[model samples]
Target: MGHVIVGVDEGPEAPTLIAVAAEMAQRHGAPLSAVTVGRDGAEQDGAPWLPDLLLRIREKHPQLQCAGFTLTGTPADEITEAASGARLLVIGSRGLSGISGIVRGSVSQAILEGTSSPVLVVPSRTTSDKHRASG
Candidate 1:
């Protein structure tokens, strides 16, 4: 089996999604990789966080095999390419909306449409909690 690849950002939900990916990886007995994609000049700037995040995760789940990667390119393309041979891909949904609250974050949508691997899009905790409180 292949590793579980997770696309993450600096958003609040990133750690949550990573935790989910780690659990999935443990369940599958596979490795976990977390990737962050940034623009040209800002590419390397965002690279450091994933390694630190992975460290924290490892501290909690010592037996889990995990790694981190940072890439420069369009988020969707980078994530799709990185997840090509992955068993599963996980991402946090920013749930950006248009004028009428229509979901407008195309990166996640594009990945969902383009990737051959299974994609798990998780909602931000604040968003989920808001929905739960409302309902």
Candidate 2:
């Protein structure tokens, strides 16, 4: 199987998607790639938090190897591209209303629609709460 790819996005309510990916990778002993869909950090409230978030995640879960990168285009497209050869694709769902997000969210739905590998969607509320408590 290919490496597990987890797509990171900024969320407001409960976006602790990375935690889910970390757990999975730790359990499966898989190499992890943490990707963000856009350059603006919509996954983390307009903050360039992917690298920092990736670092924090790595610090928390040292068992799983991780790398982080930012995709300069649409979120869903980047995610799909990243997941093309991955054993598992991870993302957060937020009910976006645009062509890209909608298509990609649906694509995520379709990707996991009838397949075997799991697509984990982290909730924003949990992540936000964690962020608040910690920060």
- Residue 2 displacement (Å), model 1: 0.8
Each model's TM-score, in the order given? 0.88, 0.65
| Total backbone collisions, model 2 | 13
| Predicted structure 2: lDDT | 0.67
Candidate 2 local lDDT, residue 18: 72
Residues 37-104, candidate 2: write the lDDT tens digits: 55444453333666677777778987778887767665666677778767787776554446876664
Q: Best candidate per lDDT, number?
A: 1
Instruction: Kindly list the per-residue Cα lDDT of model 1 for residues 7-57, writing each as its tens digit.
Output: 998767878989999989988988999998888676276566677789988
Question: Model 2: runs farther than 4 Å from truth?
Answer: 13-15, 39-47, 95-117, 126-135
How many backbone clashes does every candidate have? 0, 13
Give the lowest summed-lDDT range of ten residues in model 1. Answer: 96-105
